[model samples]
Target chain A: MSLLSLQSVTKTYGQGQAAFQALAGVDLAVEAGDFVAVMGPSGSGKSTVMNILGCLDTPSSGSYLFQDVHVENLDRNQRALLRRHYLGFVFQGFNLLARTSALENVELPLLYRGEPVAARHAAARAALEQVGLAGWETHNPAELSGGQQQRVAIARAIVTRPTVLLADEPTGNLDTRRSHEIMELLTRLNLELGITVLMVTHEPDMAAYARRVVHFVDGRVDSDQRNTPRETPA
Target chain B: MIWNTLLIALREIRRNLLRAFLTILGIVIGVLAVVTMVTLGNGATQAVSAQVASLGSNLLMVMPGQRLGPGRDSAGAPSFKLADAEAIRAQIPGLAGVAPMASSQVTVVAGGQNWSTTIQGSSRDWFHAGAWKLASGRLFNEGEERAGAAVCVVGERVRKELFGKQDPVGSQIRVKQFVCDVVGLLQAKGQSGMGRDQDDVVVMPLRTVQRRLTGSQDVAGLMISVRDGVSTSKVQQQLEGLLRERRHIADLEQDNFNVMDTRQIAETLSGTTQVLTALLGAVAAVSLLVGGIGIMNIMLVSVTERTREIGIRLAIGALEQEVLLQFLIEAVVLSSLGGLIGILLATGLSMVLADLMQVPYAFDPGINLLAFGFSAAIGVIFGYFPARRAARLDPIEALRHE
Candidate 1:
């Protein structure tokens, strides 16, 4: 069975004659350990797809199944619960809170899980170590380099051991070398942790890092293709 | 969970040190003013109550004036004669003792060291009515009042000023250059309602004071102590009626005499001071509201400034309630700190004022707790809007915030 499946999902903003459609009739499925990339032009609805999958936005009409449990109809609080237990997110800006230590940033997800301090710290440190940030645990976001900050963000995303890691233009703000480093880190996390990854990017080079690429042109998918090679140098 | 929220709040405050300090400063000043005003009010009330209680409970002062006249201004009006006191004592039922007192400020000389001092002439009951106690020797005999003897009793303050530590019971003090033997010394009574030194006077027979010092045959005021089981209100009514009948206030015109109870006056003054304190405290409480506005202002800024942080938290699965709790806790922490500092500042301010006013220090724990609770409430009242706004922010939009 697919780990995540969506059918006829639609998202609209505003109402009546002035309505704007961001997503329409979207259907997709992903199995465990799959590294998928979504590419699109501006306003192509790839970002909206990522938002829905990350549980940050709900489709106006949809059937979304995570581990075979329909979640599109769940309320906000239930969505929060689903996100905490099942998903992780990484953003382009490396949104690690300014002035917070890397370990604390990594421990953010478990904070909602109501875990004990010792358990939270243990999980956070292990996640940071997996991202090669063990020595910089006490460093704040401002003090770290962009690549390191994104690593911390990645560490935070995976600390709760979510089933899927959603990276939205995760390397959009980095240079070529730093971008490749981040992509390598994400690939390693997917391969080693057996966690699925769905990433949104416009760069063909970045999309080449994923096992599959789904391209969107407007509010709908234009092509979906399995990658011949999953390694790319940015 | 509360502890965790508190930790996050404290850290966030520390992250924005200057803003937090400025926000708390408003509450600090407000709460400090509140506590100081209340303490001063309480101290003044206490001082007046103590002074009033020292004059014996349920005592009345009957003076000659328009019956409906103001009591404070009635002091310098026409004086009551010794006959009037005798008349009231004989005619009135539920009668205790009415002591007619006559007073004049005169120069007193003892061993060539002269100073101006007050002299009072009174009958024997004046001792009980005025709550005066003799430190040495004894009170006068009733024969002295009738015969207008030259014998006298000097106060402790007068004795100390004239003879230092020496025994003043047998001393002779020259009043208006007339030698009068002091048969007793009055105990220290400190200051009185009129802010005069009560112990800086000599007491003589009513006739002696009337004839020798002032050359007037009338008394200054009458001290009437009501008998047990008789209320001052009833006595006041009876005295007013009798005085009106005797003084002949025919019709329509206010009777030219007044009777006042010391306890009643003290209570009225106490009540007035309490109201004034509360009014002033209310003014100070407005500042607490302003302080709450300050918290609100800062919280709004914090919510805006940390919008992306909120998004990250929401994205990581924080409930809206948790976000609200974090901001609310931050505001409460700031206000509570301000309250503590305000309490300390008030203590210092009240102590200094009490010493300057020569009043007793009044520090009540209940008032302190009340101030603290007020500050905390201000935090919650002012913090809720901003917190709710933050909690309702869409995570996607918040994440996109620059």
Candidate 2:
């Protein structure tokens, strides 16, 4: 069974004459240990799909299953619990809590999970180290460069050891060098930990890092293809 | 869970310390006003009761003419004489003492100093009836009272004014034209319930007051002290009947004499103080409501100011209740801090004002606890709306907020 599946998902905003459909009759499946990149123009509804996949929103009409459980049928709190245990999200803005240290930011998910202090500390520290921020635990988002801040956001996302990592333009605010560095880190996480990743990006070069790419046009999938992943520069 | 929420709340408060302090300022002033007014008012009530008790706990005063209110007396009421006091002492059962009293304001000269003070005349039983204690010397003997000798007992204020630090006992002070020897010194009694100076007079034989001072045989009033365990109301009723019969008032006529119970006076005075205290407290409580609104105002601003942060929290699997609790706890912390500081401020302020106002310092734990609890409740009452608003925000829309 696929790790995550969405069948005929349709999302609409407003009503009657003013109605706008962001996603219509879209079907997608993500299996375990897969790295898929979703790419599209600004108004092609890729962000809406990402929001639904991250469990931050529910499809207006669709059947969504995660690990055989109906995602569309879950209430708000239940969806929160699912996201807590099985999913992690990285945002385009590198959404680390301002004025908070990197370690505390990473520990937020575990804090909500009600983990013991010592265990949460240990997990958060290890996640930060995995993102090459071992000695920067106490640095706040304002004090860090864009690349370092994005690394902290990634550490926060994976602190819970979620089954899937969702990145929405994770390096959108960084320069080319930092963006390459983030892509390499993401690829390494997917290959070494066998964690599935679903990323949304507008950069073709960034999409080249994914083993499978899906292009969204209007509100439906225009093309889906597979390719050999590009090698990272030493 | 609670610990985590508290930590987050404290962190949020620390982030904007000035704003937090400003937010709780209303609560602080509200609690302070309520506590200070109540505490000082309690002290004043206690002082009034104590002064009344000092006038003799079971004492009764028979005054000519009915007292309509404070300072308003009925006209054409006949004065009591020595015979009236003698009759009450003979007829009344369970009586401690009864003394006929007459008083006049006169100038008394001693050594090189002359002081104008109230001069009172009564029998030796006056000491017992009025609960007067002697600080020095002794009361007049029966021979002196019966002969109407030129002997007097000086009160503390009279001695201080006319004799300075010198002993006034055995010293001759000229009262108007008569040279009277000071036989005793009365103890200080401070102020009376009516705020009059109690220790500012001279006491002498009633006969001397009637013949030498006023040249009249009538006494102004009678002071009666009841024995222990005797009901004052019962004695009052018996005195009313006996005086009415003695004065020969008709069955339908209003009695010319008024009987005043000291205990009743104490209760009435203290009751007035308590009502005033409650009024001031109610007025102060309005500020607490204003403080609650202040909390709501700041919390609403805080929710809006931290929208992106809230979005991040929501995206990271924080339950709606968690976000709600975080903001709610922040508000509660702010207002409770205000309450605690207000309590401390009131304690210090009440003590200082009580000393200045010449009343006892009374610390009532119940009022303090109530004010503190009420301030916290104000926080919760006003904090919930903003918290609910923050929790119900859509994560996607919130993240997009600039």
Candidate 3:
């Protein structure tokens, strides 16, 4: 059984006349440590698939197996537990709580887990340092530049040391140089921490950082291919 | 988890201090108004009770005609005589004492100092019926009462005004057309329930005022005291019947005289004040509901404002209840803080108002605690809908919200 797999997954939105199908029987699978970049146009089923994989939304029909467990059968709270224990998400907008210090923002997940104050503080500090924000713990998101804010967002995501790191256009808001830097950090985390990385990006340059790239067209996987050089250039 | 949620709530409130304060302003004012009205009302009731208690134990006052109103107060009713008081003493059983009294406003002069005061005329039983005690000197003898003696007892206020600190006993005071010898000084009985000063009067034998002051042989009122362990009501019923027969009232006609039960008057007065207090308190409580609505309004706005933030949290794997608790606790903290401040302000305000209104400052812990608990309850009640809205958001749609 793969670490995460979706077989014949389909999703529908609205009802009756407004009922629009976003996913049309897509099949995908990932091993524990693989880095896959999902590529598609705006209307393709990439985002719908990502939402299903992240457990934020349920598929209308199909079997979503996380470690061979049927994620589709899990209730909202159970899916939340799965996401809590195993998934980390990074967004393009870099959503950080406003008027809050980086350390406290990073501590949010640990807080939900009912960790003690001392443990949450220590773990949050370590995560901040890991994201190259060691001395920026006291600074709020407003005080940080866009790249720094994204780093804080990444730190918050990985604070729980999740099994799967999902990035949704992680560097879409950044310039080329900053985007390259963020891609490198994600690649390093996949290689060193052995965390599975699933990302959706429109940019080919960012997708090049992934080991495999899956292309979606009209809500189905059109092409899936491995890069020629599996190792990222230093 | 609750503690963490509470901390998060506090942080959120602190982040928007002015908005939070304004949100809870309604609660503070409601609690303040409620506590103030109830506290002051209780104080006034206590003052009334205390004043009436000082009149005498188991005492009843009988005046000619009905009580004070548009059509009554001794109008067109033949007044009592000294004989009526004698008849009550002779006929009534379980009687303690009966004193027939007549009074007129008079100006008196002593040692060249003049003061206007009320002059009361009654037999020696007046002292016994009222349970009055002398600060100095003695009551007049029976012979003096029969011969219409010019000897009198002065109250503290009259003594103070007429002779300063000097001993009024053995001194002479001129009242109307005759000079009377001051024989005793009565101890002060401060203010009465009617807000009249009880210590601003002079008392003399009933015949002296009838002859020398008013030139009438009529008595204006009767003060009757019942002995301990005796039913004042039963005695009151018999007295009413006897007065009706003596005054020649037929079976269907209302009696010319009205009797005032001190105990009944105390209850009625306090009952009226309590009703007023309850009314004001209930009105104030409605404002508390309004305050809760204010909290709900702000919380709804907050949930909408933080839609993206909630989406981020949900995306990061926070449970739905966690989000709900954060907002719920935020509202609870705001209103509870308001309750605390309101309690403090109410205490200070009621103390000042009580003094200005001449009532005792009554601090009620039960009310303060109830207000606090109620405000917290209001938070839970009003905060739920908004918190639920925040918790039940579609993470994807919420993330897309601007």
How far off is each candidate at the interface, as Cα RMSD in Å?
A: 1.1, 1.2, 1.3
Q: What's the candidate order when arranged by decreasing DockQ?
A: 1, 2, 3
Q: TM-score for candidate 3, please give it.
A: 0.85
lDDT of 2 by residue, B137-159 (tens): 99998898888899999999999
Candidate order (TM-score): 2, 3, 1
Can you write out model 3's per-residue Cα lDDT over B1-402, one digit (the tens) per residue? 788778877877787787788767867877887788888888877887777776666888889987766866566989998889889999998888888899999999988899999999998878987767999999888898899999999999999998888889999999988899999999988776667888899999888888888789999999998888888889889989999989999999877898887788787777877887788778877877676677666666666657887787788877788888887787777777888899999999999999998889988888888777777677666666755775686677778776
Real interface contacts reproduced by model 2, as a fraction: 0.65
**Chain A TM per candidate, in order of listing:** 0.95, 0.98, 0.96
| Native A-B interface contacts kept, per candidate | 0.67, 0.65, 0.65
TM-score of each: 0.85, 0.86, 0.85
Q: Write the residue-wise lDDT of candidate 1 on A70-185 in tens digits.
A: 88778878888888898999998888878888988898788778888999999999999988888898998889998999999999999998899999999999999988888888
Indicate which candidate wins on TM-score: 2
Return the lDDT, model 1, position B401: 66
DockQ of 2: 0.57
> Relative to the unseen true structure, what is the C-alpha lDDT of residue B139 in candidate 3, on a scale of 0 to 100?
89
List candidate 1 stretches off by more than 4 Å. Answer: A16-18, A228-234, B1-32, B68-78, B89-96, B105-117, B136-185, B191-202, B230-254, B325-370
Candidate 1 per-residue lDDT over residues B21-71, each given as its tens digit: 977787777778788878887887788778778888868898776544255
